[model samples]
Target: LGYPCRDLLRAWIHELDPDSRQRVVGRAVSAPRPPQLKKLAVLELCTREGSAQVVAQKLGVSRPTLYNWKNQLLG
Candidate 1:
């Protein structure tokens, strides 16, 4: 399957009940991973206008988080 399909399936499976998922896989499954923010992408967004508030709001993260990501990425 394509990457998109695999990602979709993975997301769908992650949404399944833990018991059902364990039953299907015959083993314990870890919790779904959090969304990862790319350092470069975050830095690039920081460069854009209205990124501090607008972009951060759209991304569901705080404005300070954008700065933290930028600083960490640069260091």
Candidate 2:
């Protein structure tokens, strides 16, 4: 009864669509991670094919930078 309005709104959303909260607020509420984690994620997607360019683009870094991160993290 203290915060029925807010609680009811969340409950309604949950009842209508269980995934609505995730779709609407999950990413928004996520805590910011370090750059190393992002670099590692991008590196994991890298393959022997043309993935370097694609992943590098996604990380906002150059191809050489991606390779550098790979060496830094893996080697």
Global fold similarity of model 1 (TM-score):
0.43
TM-score, each model? 0.43, 0.40
* Top candidate (TM-score): 1
Q: For model 2, state the Cα shift of residue 8 in Å.
A: 78
C-alpha lDDT of residue 53 in model 2: 78
Task: Name the 10 consecutive residues with the lowest summed lDDT in model 1.
Answer: 32-41
* RMSD, every candidate, angstroms: 15.0, 10.9
How many angstroms is residue 6 displaced in model 2 relative to the true structure, after the best TM-score fit?
72
Q: Estimate, for each residue in 1-75, the C-alpha lDDT of model 2 and write its tens digit.
A: 455788888998899999766445453344554777766755565654656778778666667866776776667
Prediction 2 global C-alpha lDDT = 0.67
**In candidate 2, where is summed lDDT lowest over 10 consecutive residues?**
22-31
After superposition, candidate 1 runs with Cα above 4 Å error: 1-36
For model 2 the local lDDT of residue 63 reads 76
